[model samples]
Target: MKKSVNKTITIRDIALSCQVSPSTVSNILSGKRQVNSAAGKKVLAYAEKIGYQKIHQQRFKKAIHLILFRKHKLILCDTPVFSALVTALDNCCKAQGYALSLSYIDALTLGEKATQKTISQIISDPTTPILLLATEMSEQDFHLFENAKAPIMVIGNLLPKVPFNIIDTDNFEAGRIAVQHLIDKGHTHIGIISSSVPFDSAKKRKQGALYALQEHDFPIKAEDILYLSPFAEETSDNMTQVIQNRKEQFPTAFFAINDYLALGAMHALIQHGFSIPKDISLIGMDNMPFDCLVSPKLSTIEAPIEETARQAVLRLIALTQETEQYIMKSYMGVKLVERDSVLDLNTCK
Candidate 1:
């Protein structure tokens, strides 16, 4: 019986047989450049003669990359949510022994070419895995994932239309519950500080709040809603516009989309000398870093950030292991964390 050797052929073998440099052989095989017809023929003949085959690329490095879609460079400082997210993801990765890397995407950074250079490197490597901690993922971002073999998990509270795996908090439920909490406290007319995510992202959350209101039969007037900037710092002028335009039209109790909105709205209220909880009860989500440090601790919805991070790492590992183990949707539940910011209007009178 003849022995069948199981071995991958080398570019060196083809180069030597064709009397060409290894780099020329590599360029030909990688399809980076076209060789002359005569040279091409020589290489192809050599390949046929030796039954040359490409070596199977090795993987199994067991590291994951977390890519953040930072449309603005100031996402970290502007939205402290990233701080919590990074902390949670880092601790989780450490526990699981997986590596994490971050890259921000912006017009200036990826202007002429949306090729996320850092991400391109990772994708080019066959072994590494990827998770995207993204907000406002664009057409270009989708292009990056077209043929990617690595499992992609997008971390956010909103549901995007992308087909990649998503691990997120239930912002819609968060919205509904935040408003409902105010209603339970006997505030009939509740207002909201809406978020400024992209249209596709923000629609469902706002709809969820309305669904809760209608479900509970709470009358929510449209004028009471306030949306703040997602990309920029809080400005007094914007808050002033909301108050001037919407003061008497809405409820005293407010459900701000996230904690940052609550803080910015609080600053506007303070500037106008409005008493917290005495005149207006406020609720925000995400229990941001400033929540504890502020004068009146914000009554807010607390998402399980640390736990979300821990689970994301595990999910990535599993996806890498079993093809069927891939996860498409994961939502972290949220709870209300009450503080001094909200007042029972019943007690006020």
Candidate 2:
């Protein structure tokens, strides 16, 4: 037998070898459409064996990139709600026949050079769409996406001024519902334990709380509201000092911006010899897992974390496929998850 030299195998050659149409092979390679898993595997394996170089040149070739734009160390992995969103995004990507790549844009310390580098890599390939986990992103942080080529969608509680597609929970409504629950319990005097963090969700929650107070004709006392540091230990210490200092003016009930802050306030109040829902009533938002694990199960507002993630991914896909145009600002609803943490003031007397 005579020796034969290897020739360059084109997509048509691969398609012919796999006994599938060239379009099917191209679709499989580009991740443009879902093909039979066995057929896809066969094509991929054969292409790899023949040393496919075209696919290697592509960036984000057949995947969705999840960029976590955070200003703090507590990125998506640190918080349970964010974790749920990530999980949902992963599942959604898998279902859509796309691989998901995760990257972090630490806007907290993002310099010009680094920002340009990240933007370059993102726009390097127009086929790969970007799904931004921008829940914590500010208006300035969103400017990074101004020159991006790939389709982008944001998942968070608030939308930035830039008109990109966004899917977020209705934090304002969550705040309103939380405070209304306390009001329904006949707590005319209520406090909101908040932090100085510049989170949109936190701000909306505060606005909602104030709205509820105004609706019920309850006096909004500056003395009743307590502001603490964002850090857990600092929050705990500040809450303790505030509670002790304002003991005489303490409100009958307290609503925390989130479960963590709520937990901090609860611990401090208890340390100051005030029992939860006994000497003081408490409620929180975020429906964090700790809410259920605590000594007194915490009542909280459930943020639509997973649903927002799923919707964001779906919207991103739609954008990439050109099935939808015009940026959309979508809001997911929130619900009150009542547990043992709240006290019905009517029953107390």
Candidate 3:
């Protein structure tokens, strides 16, 4: 009788079984390089089935990965809000002895395969925590992160019914406060400047504003709601046409979904001979730095970007330390920042 030999399963064995290169298996397991999602999944499944053990690499310091997922560049840019959030996250991570790394994934241009590949690489190391800046990510885009092994947290957006850690501003409350402020100022007819891109945050804000309008018995008119392009230039052009055509019946006040849109609307109004506060009071969300620089400083609802970042980092760190974890969802409060743009109609008369 010949003695049977038991050999440890290796990367080469898994690669040959899965019909892929050893380097491919190594990259997928080590997360040193990006691998195709399909191939990676297959390789991972096979390795798990065969009980293949991979030698873990030692690292000197812990790391946190921040992935900014944008469906379109027009909506998510290097604006004050983006800069502030990133800086805050970096600071928080450094304070906790974790090195922060950032990655931007454009889903529209990369398509599903490439995006998934990049995401897989980021989540390959289960030891590293991930923070997804999902401001422009759709509900469908979330499916990719569903199977992530890393402790993941989403920022600047809310995902209902999806189990994940999230920290976002109370966009609904922000919208409600903006519109309510306008209403309290004696503005009867109000208009909304919404984006053509259907972002979850924008949708929630619009819904909240609508709720406030309905609560106050204000008539909701389809024509009053203007859907503008995400780009500032395009938004201005679109608003210009709307203002020209509706000059006779334009609303007294407009609640722009964001500060950029508000500035675009302001430009159109100014060019068309309409005065801010005097002719049309305007309010916006996201108290971006530029809001204060513009003539007739914009009144906006502060989005709590820094607070959201801090909370997200804290929760993600907690998740990484836990033996048992639960899906956590948090909404930071938003407040109205008064400025010169919105007129107090009650004081007018």
lDDT of each: 0.67, 0.77, 0.82
The better-scoring model by lDDT among 1 and 2 is 2
TM-score, model 2 to reference? 0.79
TM-score of 1: 0.74
Q: Note the residue pairs that clash in candidate 3.
A: none
Error of 2 at 162 (Å): 1.7
TM-score of each: 0.74, 0.79, 0.82
TM-score-sorted candidate list, best first: 3, 2, 1
Candidate whose lDDT is highest: 3
Give per-residue CA lDDT, model 3, range 170-264, as digits (tens): 88988899999999999989989999888888998999899899999999799999999988778899988887788458899999999989999
What's each prediction's clash count?
0, 0, 0
Poorly placed runs, candidate 3 (over 4 Å): 1-60
**Model 1 global lDDT (CA atoms, 0 to 1):** 0.67
Query: What is the per-residue lDDT of model 1 for residues 1-349, given as tens digits with 9 covering 90 to 100?
Result: 9999965455555766787655455445534346567887688667757654222122112456666665545333424566557656755664576544544445456664565564566567667677676655554556666566676666763444567667777878888888888877888887777765554335555676788788878777767777777443654457767777764644778887767778788878888778887778888888887798987889998888888887778777777778565447877888989899988765656
- Judge candidate 3 against the unseen true structure and give its global Cα lDDT, from 0 to 1: 0.82
lDDT of 2 by residue, 244-323 (tens): 67647688889998888898888888888888888788889888877888878999999777677778888898898785
Regions of model 2 farther than 4 Å from truth: 1-61, 74-77
Better of 1 and 2 by TM-score: 2
Q: Specify the highest-TM-score model's number.
A: 3
